[model samples]
Target: MGESDPFIQRVQDVMNAPPLMVEEKESIQHTAEKMVDQQASSIVVVNEKQRLHGIITEKDLVQRVIAADKKTGTAADIMSASPYTISRRAYYYEAMSSFLMNGIKHLPVVNEDSTSQVVGMITLSDLLKKQNRGKFDVLREIEASSSESLADVKFAIYEVLGHLIDDGIPILHIMKVVTNLYDRLIRHCTELALEEVKEEIGSPPCDFAFFLMGSGGRHEQFMMTDQDHFLVYEEPAKEEDRQTNDAYFKKLGEQIVYWLETAGYKRCDGNMMASAPGWRGTIDHWEDRIRTWGLRATNENILLGQNFLAFRWIYGSEKVRDQFVRGVSRQLGKSKIFLRRAAELEKNVPVPVLDHPIRALFRVKKEGMDIKKQALFPFHHSLQILSAEHGILGETPEEMIEHLKEKRVLDEPFADELLYAYEVVLHIRVTQSWDRYKLEEENSSEVSFRQMKSRDKEALIQALKAIRSLQTKAVATFGMA
Candidate 1:
């Protein structure tokens, strides 16, 4: 009893066997080369029945024949006669330690009968990546969400990202998925807020547009972005209409923001909150405001263009948002005057750039520039303006890219790359936010280009450079495209 293997449970826990693989009769050299190409350390040797044969690994290559200056042509002469075997019924720890202690990467697993064909193979790296603390909490929350528990749904959003942290899923893909759920959660909160106050808000078709700006608008929101949004309703023609529900919508918007903050998103710092009167306006008023924003270029508009083009709708009727889009778009396309103004505003928006010459001449600014401002902002805002000009309606930057691509303004490859870059930027932002918030660093809202890790920093810089290169080409050919 005392001598029994402690790893039996672990090996049995993770199912293992073999993969759909090439047969053993295949050229040994071909199989060994394929193994190296797949980044697999060893090849699972099998016959037509898919029964395990002696395995061939790097060790076999170096120690047995390759090192002896023998050609890797024949499997029979070079392959080891007896390969180590572990029952599929064994535990993960046993398989893992066997792989680790023996320095083998691939292990063929068999059945409890000790003679069944090979099943699945387990890798140490994959097993480690899948290990996490909140795995069960996340699964439980998913179940709860299926049961219509809003609280669990809210908790799931936070838990998913946290579990991602624990599981070491690449930050990029995790952020892309997180971005999806964040919008869903925010929309859920908006509906809940409206339901809570609907009794007090009599129907006026007083349609409201939920305007999300900055990272939220870009679908690039990190873990830290508060919902920087606004609410717009059609101006009431009647005095009674005006007097009754204005305060109620204001209160409702505030409650929605409050609920979102409680759920996880912090409040916007610039007081760009939907609760603010400056951000809350009627449909007609919003139209006029958007026109003014398009026609008149100002320092504030450029200072905040990163946030401005990031503007979009998170919830409410798409028709209402559609109408707003029409107003904004028609004005943009019809008036070359306004279009030119918009184009000028685009140039007005400065991005992070390192003068390669200047950096060589002198030291580069330690922080570089805000990558969002320099890289993501240009592409993000250009798409927004382009959409408004093209009469394309979209609630998020991802939507805008799709819309433009459908219009043939964007090629699939370039659009795909842009979206990939945007996701990577969001990944970088989330990590930066988490670190800053934890360290109590100032300006967590803006992630500095320098804060990125060496690989990430280089990748982002390359992304920014590519974006600028493309932007220049587009500008030269299309003129404000």
Candidate 2:
């Protein structure tokens, strides 16, 4: 399950090539026959240039032709247009992501050089056939789950994570794969909550967006994660309508939290969840709150704003989410005082000093450090402050660093150094957390330096140094030096 493993291999390595295809003008009868002859579940639709036009699957055939009772039609008439596709160069995880996100089973593979040239076709079955059952079983289970059975799916995730770790998969890739599963789990919970809410109260009164903040928002969760979410509904034209909308959303939020908790995510101790009043509001209310956070710049206000600044929309109206995000960026752009205060606070937080093993041997007991607080936080907090100041709305620290690099706000070499340091720190944190989970210990971020391999200890020390440098740079950038 290492890099050379087929599970991590390129799509071209596993995709079924010489894909069954039918010309656009081919009769529907002929298309069905081709599928039957090839024993294919799906066939690609192509035009004169051997380029992909669309795709036809058994579902399409049954629903579009058979169910419609159509006597005759061309492939072009019934084919699903602009179907999703993947590149031959993509990894298996990419295909898995596409399938999971789009809820598509068959993915036509295209040539990297010629984007439309059908190189192969991959199906969910293809992936399932190649990888270990444990890896994909969670996805199927999550998708099929509709009840409290979803609670079991959360435990299944750790098993999958263990397998990935054993396979020597990169921590970052593991993060993406696990994040997708969690996203699906959260989305499924949201759906169930919505259904219950609909049954209890009719349809929603207005458009709204449910979003995640903190680590979940940044797609950085590795082991257990707590709830850090909010809701933003469209402003009602009338006061009465506003109250109605608020009541409906309040119930909806509570139900969502209930389902997520059932699925094993703990409630945020800080109460940064949709179930809380302050976390769910109209766009106007949210905008005003954002302005207040900047205008006030109190310690608590800055912390609250910092959490919200990492928000990523999970469900509901993208239009609403975009509007809210735009409002946040606009407010942040004008909040120089808030940014400066945030930087100053971040600068004042002490990073843990990793003592050399030789220097620590004389101590009565070895010291354990919270890698998250000491290393990861400095990297993320610094980037977060910088990103907010520059109006760069990248959700994750990596994205923020790249955005800053693009804007020339951070020099290329320095940004690269910061990214590498962040990765090293994150790798250590996730692995340590995973190890603790396996021992059935309480979820803790503490990493014992004495237990780490010499190389790891050295790597962590270097990462912490880089983080400190970034903190210094952030303070200077905000004129707090």
> Which structure among the candidates has the greatest lDDT?
2
Runs in model 2 deviating more than 4 A are: 2-12, 17-41, 46-53, 58-72, 82-105, 110-119, 132-134, 237-239, 353-366
Q: TM-score for each prediction?
A: 0.58, 0.88
In model 1, the worst 10-residue window by lDDT is: 1-10
Query: Which digits, one per residue and each the tens of the lDDT, describe model 2 over residues 1-481?
Result: 5432544678998899889998999999999998999999999999998899999999999999989998798999999989999999877766876787688999999988887899899999888787764556676778778665878988777777777788878777777777767888899899999999999998989889999888888888876688999999999978878888999999999999999998888998999999999999999888788888888999999888777777788899989988888887887777678888888888789575555554564273756778877777777778888888788773777788889998898999899888778878888888888887888788788888777787877777777777888888888897766
Clashing pairs in 2: none
- Cα misplacement distance, residue 481 of candidate 1 (Å): 12
Write model 1 residue lDDT over 162-199, tens digit each, in one string: 65555556655455556655665676677667766776
Lowest lDDT block of 10, candidate 2: 355-364
> Residue 128 deviation, candidate 2, in Å?
4.1
TM for candidate 1 is 0.58
